[model samples]
Target: MFSQSVRSFTKQALQWSRIKLVHQRITLTKFTTLFFYLALFNCIILIALQTVAFVDNEDATEIITGFLNQANVTQDHIIYISNNELLKCKDLPSLSDANCETWLQEDDGDDDNDSNDSKSRRSLGGFFSARSVSVPRHHSENAKTEKYSNGTISGLELDNGKVLDTSCIQSLIWLNDVIHDSMAEDVVTLVFQIWLFFLSLATILNESLPHLGAAIAGHVLVTAWAGYRIRNTHKLREHYQELIVHQVCEGVDFLGAWWDVRTDHTIPILVFNVIAFVLATYLATRLYRVYARETFNRVRASPRLHKIYKLVLVLSVCVQLSGFFTVAATAMWLDKASTGSINRVAKHLVLYRAVFSTMAVLEIPWAILGWICIRSENRRQFWIFAGISVLLLASSSAIFASPLYQFIFQTWPFFASMTIVSYLLILVITVLGVWSRTQFGKGLPEFLKEEEKLEGADFAPVYIPDLKDRKSFDSEKGHGSDIDTEPIASLPPLLASQPLHKPPPAEKRYRTSSVYSDINRDTVKLSSTPPLAQAILSEQSPVSDCPPTPNRSNFETASRSPLSRTPGDRSERSRNSLPGNPRPINIQESSSGRPGRTGLIRI
Candidate 1:
């Protein structure tokens, strides 16, 4: 009786342990579900935009002074320029009389040379000076002037103009001497404070209209023919839309001097994030297949590719830093026609921004890679970090910063554009993730070995279906948050269902993976597929070769009801798997916690 009681107690403990483990797992999953994507949804709109109406005429006056200085410096200097022109008056030859600078002809004799010298001396009466050149100005506001680089004003006029700081881009162009006429200046001439009043009215009206119409429409659509399904799908669509709106509408939606910080220092820091985003999304994405997927497996075992990956990592960091420089450029150049003192200050803003945020955006990929390396048990921790990293990047880029916000706040124009770029950034991140996953899935014998070991196990009971030919895994049914088709559907009673021996407890938790080892280091031979052909990616892998998963009894069962596939766990395994021409996987999963992983793998 004692022995029997001990056995019963042991059985109950084991069962209780499993239940507790499951409960803990469920709680962790729910926590991750609540936090990870919630943060992602919140981050879509944290852009700062506030309009500062420039009341000072000093900045405008300074711009005019610089132009006048430039005109004065170049006016008297005779220019024989087409492709290039002398930047400083001193660089030009001193004019002599009616005939300016002329190349000396040695054979023309000393008399002609002397005559030429005299002509040159005559023209050099007013040796290049700041007072030489002038800018042409009309008598009044309506004066029409054409062909302005050579035009100059004899007298100085300091006109004070007011503009929204958001109008900085147009202002920059005007200052750069890009716009040659007063007509271009007229755009900023109108009083815009009245528009603010109208804007307030519109905001009120927009608020007054209770979105009940939209809400009712959503309910009616959900209730019509397919209530459960329509409601779910409709809700999903609405949620996605709300997510976007939330991103776009984050923070104090006021654009009045909110960007004064850009005018001060944080400009280049912002620019760095922009650059990282652009290169990671635009440049890195282009070669991601070659670097991450194509060459990754080949270099998995080679120290050379590791160095290359490190190089890529370094380059990515550099590009992020480069983004800071781009912002620095913005800071310096985002001003109106200003003098060297102002431009110099702008450049300092760039450098300052760089030093500040170098680590923030630079660590984005490292955070992503960390999540990639996490074991499933600890996945939630890593994913939280991943979400944080992505959010940091989004905030850094100002993806939610809109031009309208800038219009109100009078700041850098690109800040608003930067908000929109978050979409591209997310897409790029998705691409990088897919490429990484795909590379991981395809290459390294170790990865294959893990899949094989899992396949051989009776406890987990995973089926290795032929996935190389399909677009993606078709079975999204699973016990996890990943949104993949045919993902793991939890453990089945495989040992009881069939007369198969379960592996010893010691062997169950782990297996040796040689994915990174024992590859032919000779010239690689690529797998043959048409230039454009579809292929499936599987997280399900095998050891060197997984022993056939099919039960021997499957063939001999007497009453085989046509071997119909089960509704759940009824999919066909690969009938005849092909030899792998292994490459690295490149896939990016989402934090959305949908039915499956986003599986952002590419061809």
Candidate 2:
């Protein structure tokens, strides 16, 4: 009767266990599928953004071509073209030998009624009309006919038979071509695409691998790519500066006319890349420590250090993003030169330059300070520091977005795009700020947390004892079996059946080396040397015919019969006459480094 009752209870327990196992399997499968779909979508978005950035190169090239057309070097817009020897057209010495066709075209009605205001507006507007016109007859013929035997046009012969040097025009054209090609090969676009691809690959890798080393490597590569981008942009900025100076030296007042020389995009690109490279470097450090299996406490000073690091990053991002808006503000302010004071424009320009220069110059030292603060014992102090810093930053933004500067967004298409990008960056930074707060460590991105979870799920195995070796102490006690004859290995079912009782206080901290106990293996050999198991055994009372006090040494020597075995094992084993196995207990330290036995089962 006792055995029959035990078997019935065990059968019901087994049925419930099977149901829970199925449910858990379904849950895990759903999670995996969700990640797979998300990764695919992420890849698509990244590829599209890269394609758009690449297409922007063509737009840049078109802007340059449009600027050159507006210069109208072939037209009688002599005011727009510099009269320097490098660029100026030569005048006819005298019309003695010149035919009517040899004389420059002139129309009395064209200049008669045009006011200075209209001329200035026309110069500011398209300066050159958008129509296909042949190059001037005098200059075009000389340019083509003066070609050397090497097929290179050395110079164009003027109407007076003197040559106008081609070197300056050729150099400017070459620089334009080089800038266009550089834009096409933008490192940001290429790096971002590659980074996203590796990130996508990480999601797939999580399905089978135990670590996200590939994704970590991608971040390191991106940091280097960002540095490369900054170098290229710096070189480009130098070229633009040189061109502006050249134009100024030749008395060309239209220095601001060329979009290539005065881009609202480059400043933003430069600032953002600097910030990103710094952040990526920090990110790589975080990932490397994890990959190397280092403890968090050893890597970082305290919980506060992480918050401080994040705060610093947030500040840098916000400051650099403001530089984008400054560019727009400068453009719009300069556009109102007819109505607004040049002093006001110059003041805003100097202020923006000062702000940008300050941030760029201090970025490295600020990062160094953040690194130093990571070792700080106090965590809450950074919050106070960060709050004050943010308030100052906000004040700076407000200054840039003041009523005086709002006209830029209203005046130029460049500022309009800058306005949109500014808003988008705001949204992005806000989301990142919120997400950073939820992280467990300093400089750890959300993606790394997800990767860690995936890795744990893939590698951490749950141990389940075999049902055949399962023994029920309650059934044995009722069946009049000899309790003394039961092995120590069979005590789990008895301990599991006992009513919940308060565990005794620890005598001392017991530290034991941990090992991976594979669930698929034939046996999990638990060492009785652990004081934790001893404490548990000491709590149990002896029954009739059982030892009054169980000897711990006896359990140490007796080989524990494995409760579970892999299905592939061919060795036959005795089956339990009655019900389910006791739940498996696990004791391992968590990531945060809390020590001692955990997850001991009651049933």
Query: Which of the numbered candidates is closest to the native, going by highest lDDT?
Result: 2
lDDT of 2 by residue, 1-603 (tens): 999999999999999987775444323433333433443454455455445555655555554444343332232211111111122122211223212121111112344555634533443243234111122222232232355698665554445564444433333342344444444344334544444445434434333221233333333444454455556554444433333322322212112333333343444444444454454445344333323232232243356644554453454444333333333323333433222222232335656555545544443343333322323422464444344345434644675554444433332333344445544444444444444445435444433344355445646432222243213322221232333544555669888577665434454322222223324423333533344454544343322221122133322223331111112112211111112322223323233445322322112
lDDT of each: 0.30, 0.38
lDDT of 1 by residue, 1-603 (tens): 999999999999999987775444323333222322322222221111111112212334344345334334222322221111111121212212224332221122255557645533433332233112342222113222223365543322323221112111111222223212111111221111122223222212222111212222212221231223223323322221222111221211111122232233233323432432333233222223222332334222456435434433432332332232233322332332133222321324454345335534444454444433432223455456456546545544561243222321232222333223333444454344334433433233454345345434556333333345122222122133243663334336663455544444643333322223425422222233232322222323322232222222322231221111111111212221112222222221223333221111011
RMSD of 2: 23.6
Q: Let me know the TM-score candidate 2 reaches against the reference structure.
A: 0.28
Residue ranges of candidate 2 with Cα displaced over 4 Å: 1-345, 348-350, 358-396, 402-419, 427-603
Per-model TM-score, in order, reads 0.21, 0.28
